[model samples]
Target chain A: MKLTVTIAGVELKNPIMTASGTFGSGRDFEPYTDLNKIGCVVVKGVASREWAGNPPPRIVETYGGMINAIGLQNPGIDVFCKEDIPFLRQFDTKIGVNISGKTIDEYVEVAERLASEDVDLLELNISCPNVKEGGVAFGVDPFMAALVTGAVKKVARQPLIVKLSPNVTDITTIAKAVEDGGADAVSLINTLIGSRIDIHKQKFILSTRQGGLSGPAIKPVAIRMVYEVANAVNLPVIGMGGIMSGEDAVEFMMAGANAIAVGTANLLDPAATMNILAELETFMRNKQIEDVNDIVGVVNKAAISP
Target chain B: MNQSINRSRTVCKIISNRPLVDQVFEIILACPEIVKKVRPGQFINLYCRHSGRLLPRPISVCEVDLRNGHLHLIYAILGKGTEEFSGYKAGETMEIMGPFGNGFNLDSSDGNYLIIGGGVGTPPMVELCKQLKGKKTIVAGFRDNPYLVDRLKQYGDVYITTDNGSAGFKGHVVEFIEQRGLKGTIYACGPAPMLQGIQAYAKKHGLQAYLSLEERMGCGFGACVGCVTKVVADTDTGWRYKKVCKDGPVFDAGEVLFP
Candidate 1:
């Protein structure tokens, strides 16, 4: 069966990609999961300059998922090129860099810095909720979302995929806004705002108080958002949020996502991506499906009023 | 790709899960591959049967039964994940991915060792104590009567300290060290306060020391820059977060900034 899927003019060998921030520039999962097997390795969010990230207690386990306020801690673009890029280039899979910045200029600067670098695509991470500024700001509003996308698109050397936050009221508006701003593709939903209180301690578990929630718990919300966005925009949609198994992946594709990403599942099992790919293939064979892309948006429905 | 990494997921069967003391249990898994590769202080992320609690709990290697191809993991019933783990039956299988993180460096020189572990951290010291070559003295701290001290006693002279004075000395490990005038190249893994006290004592005594740190982790491997600890940095930021999961669960007592 043909598993190949296209996103933003780039033809991925398979529709399976590691969600940015979940996979650490391909180093963390390099041991168990081969980089060549998956469609792409979307590295963690990197800024133009190094970020220290938040203080301790950045993660807490919830019912079906975990919350993280990692604050996009990275060694910056220079380190990414020197350390991660060479390592990833050795693999046959496509590389997608997730860029994080505190301002529109910072976003543009990150895009410009990677402009000449050899990479497959750029994912503008304007939806990270842990930071004080930049990430959640540009993503929550349609104006700011479009503005950041337009600015990054102008300078990005590779096709741009704008990752959207699910914390907003209207995810479709922001998806359409990024599409208007020249985003080659749109990926959603980037974790719902979630919090956990330690009843014993009677305090919040995470230092940030609220963190991005991703896991099987948020899968249904992601599907709904993916379905709506696919119908609302002409841009290709990359669906992600708590995808754990091959069956869950097929469900996302059927909900109108051209490709799907594996996020929190990677943490639970670094081999999750490879396992997911095999499971997806197995699913296709069992269903007598000839091509993987043939199942995209199969759960056809008209866009609900937004 | 570099040729060194061979990490993969394996479903290992449990051989035993019995409580050694109040709320503390020792689980033995018949995992030959992991036992063969596990160093003294290395850890494994153990998964439970619950679908709601997704992330696997990180448990240290308590002992290595190389002859039987068994791995011992001791854990306290602290949180829901571990509590769920406490109920696992012997015949049931658990999925795990590790032998991850850097284990303690049993530096071969001089080798007069002072192994210190506190509370739940004490279990890892059992494996560590077994591996040390030269003079070994182990000090473990707990809230009450110690459970693993017997296992530790098999390898070295074991000292115990309790917060309630119900067992051994009525104090923390550092206080016990002060009373005994303990001096050696120190190796320790414990809570932040105990580790900080050890760092200070080691610095004041001018002794070489190694520390294993514990932090809230996101992914037990290197992804998700969660589980970061402050470390001394020379850059403008002065101190930066190094992944406790990757850079350490073990660090030089001197290099870590407990502040």
Candidate 2:
């Protein structure tokens, strides 16, 4: 059984991509695993202009999770265009550009620029915590989400996947709004908003009081949200949050996700992307599945059905 | 993309075995691949046994002996993970990866180099000394009779300072630097206060200074941006962040924004 997946017009050998921020522009993890083997590689988050990111203590490790406030630190759009994106094009794997912005125009500007070029997909990441305006603001509000989506949709020539933030009262509403605004697909449950305090230091480990949480701890919430958004919106859903294993990947697939992105897992294991791809293949071979897409939404609700 | 790194290692010995000090022994199986690649300020990540240890421990590669194929790692018994690492011995293997991350870039062109290291931080400077083949003065500070300086005598000019003056210099390493009229580039590592003093001294004299910082690292590699040192850019905002594990474990003293 071939575990091939095509999301929002881009073909993926597998659904496991090293999430936007976790994997550094294909340089760090290139040593551990074959970059071409694992589905697509979503490079680091790129902003319309250059960004220096946040202050010190960008990340903290909790019991089962890690909190990060890495404020979308990238070399900006110009550098990405001239330096990163050009280097990324050399790889055979699908290249998805994750874009973030402070204003709707910034988002559109980045999307418009990316659109002019040939990219497999564009993921609108609107969940950065360190930024003041836009980011989570656009994500939490369904109207703002649609507005940004609509703005980018007008000029975006490549497949647009609106990455939905999990920091909303009702994510389903935002999901539908973005779908209505013309998103080809949606990747759901970006890091949940959370914080950790140190008793000894008597202050937050992260200089920023709160940070977005991701890792093995957030998998359940991510899956539930993916299911919710999947039910609400008609677009294909890309699910992710603490997907560490193939079984976890399958769980998301059964929960109505068309594909999944591996975020925090890659940090835990250097070779996680390729490892999950091989594990997914092994799973397909054992289950005797013909096509990987057929398993999407194939929920095992034996107890619930009975 | 190349699937394997040029250098890699495995932890052959663990050290729940108690040493004289509150330290753990993570004796690496073979140091050849790692030792050959490691420079002064580089570190190795010892993958401890999966008995509850989730994060790999980042220890300064104290001494690398390519001939014996052993890299000695002495870590303070901080937690359960480190305590467990101190116990394991020969034949038992733990995943060890490295000679990873950028190291100290020391340029001793003038041959007039001043080296200062505090406590456990002195070990890394050993390699830096080996590379220096000229008039170099080493000023090492320790709490009491920590076994770092006694063995470091063969490197270059050796000067020791204990907190209680149980060692060489009665005061501090900086005192020795002041008394000796140590000039030229200064390379320092150790506790924050010592590094800060060195930074201030360098600033006063307008001399070049570099310092290696230690942070509570989660990944040792850049993946988990846990270990971070505050750096003040000379620009308008006057400050930025750089990963100590990646961007530098060693940096120009003038570059660091001391809190």
Candidate 3:
């Protein structure tokens, strides 16, 4: 019953982690569940400077999920290091800091700042669709993706995990590009670029008109992309999109992800990460699985063998 | 009272869920944890047990019966999430997390409390009015037919206005405020237009006002940063985003920038 999983030399007690933006450095959800029960807490995206984010009406409910154009609102590295880092350090779980910026220099600066911090890993965010600038740019293009990955890798003291944007022509190319750029691992998919309209008002639902779609609706696409990236790159893959339950996390692992991050589900249930972990363990016990790692990429083997 | 109340997720049994007016419903839940912590202007994020409705619907605390350990939530059938709530019946249960956001600061001033609420925003004011001492005047504006006037009457002198003039005062609530010349520290909530009108009215009279705002929210807690409103700042560029779910669902009337 070994549930522990290793990603880029870091060992997590379990495979369940909170997705960036959904869990704000583990402070918000502390009331509902114990932070020590989670394997890792992937906090919201942090930039070199404080981000004011976007205007109001930043989120809207769709059919199976929701859309958000938060524009990566954060308190910047200085405040995050001062406040969020110390708060998260009280927990037993590993810490994965998600970095966002409008340029390579901003990314490198934040990475360098966190270089001496007590974080366990650095998640390079090049695929945030809500921001107008650097987020989707580096992620959508292979060359730029590699360039940013290489730039951050130089200063990032923690093992770098490049998060890929789902709004791309070929995700594998970008995944390969980061691997070549010396990334320790990769996480996909950030979010799909989508929009919704208010028929009654005859206007876009989100103030930004377009937003990144997440939740159960994007789970299928995320699983597909994770499968593709895991096959294309040698790096370990952390899969996330719309993981709602323990079954969903297991599905992602079987599809070729070493671990899974719970995103929009945390919004619905604050204790989602711990609940999903229990569900994952229940899933293991029922299936007579000794090690959770035994299920990783198992679907691919079945698909190829037969 | 605990300064920092820990938010919890619990299954609250429904004591009653029935229509109050057209597309408006009143639900009473028996949850002591929520009833104990909830203050006026605080909200609860309600989860619809029905599958496919993944996001929680944020509803303000309309009333708290501490003796019975029951909490009252009044909401309109605005969309699918609420429509599902409309279908829930007594003996049923639903998941909820709360009492979130900074509740109204009850200690601001000693002036007569002018509690103005429009449509669904009227509910939270009921609780606020009940707890306040001294003179309390409640002015409520509805789209057409008014609901909850009787409950509001118990707390103070209740004034009513309807869009179609089918009720107490003819025309908009702001028009009623303009004509009546009511004097007090204004505590208001409603659509942006109504709040903007109140903000203007407060400025003209040199009165302090507090407004409760509504926005599309993700996590009812502060995590997602999806529910933000622009507020006046002192810097050269004069505005910054504050979480409506955390920094406020209630804000100083003069500080909010209504667009």
Q: Show model 1 residue runs off by greater than 4 Å.
A: A301-306, B1-7
How would you class the docking of model 2? acceptable
Q: Each candidate: fraction of true contacts kept?
A: 0.87, 0.15, 0.73
lDDT of 2 by residue, A100-211 (tens): 9988899989988887776788988876666778888888888888999989989998889988888878889999999999999999778888898887879988878888
Between which residue pairs do clashes occur in model 1? A215-A242
Stretches > 4 Å off in candidate 2: A300-306, B1-20, B23-31, B50-53, B164-172, B216-218, B223-240
lDDT of 3 by residue, A161-271 (tens): 999998888899999999999999999989788899999999998989999999999999999999999999999999999998889999999999999999998887787
Alpha-carbon deviation at B190 in model 1, angstroms:
1.2
Task: Score candidate 2 by lDDT.
Answer: 0.77
DockQ of each: 0.60, 0.34, 0.53
Worst 10 residues of 1 chain A by lDDT: A297-306
Best by DockQ: 1
Residue-level lDDT tens digits of model 1 in A124-173: 99999999999989999999999999999999889999999999889999
Q: Which ten residues in a row have the lowest lDDT in candidate 3 chain A?
A: A266-275
For residue A250, model 3's alpha carbon misses the true position, in angstroms, by 1.2
Output the better candidate (1/3) by lDDT. Answer: 3
TM-score of chain A of 3: 0.99
User: What lDDT score is found at residue B27 in candidate 1?
Assistant: 90
Indicate which candidate wins on lDDT. 3
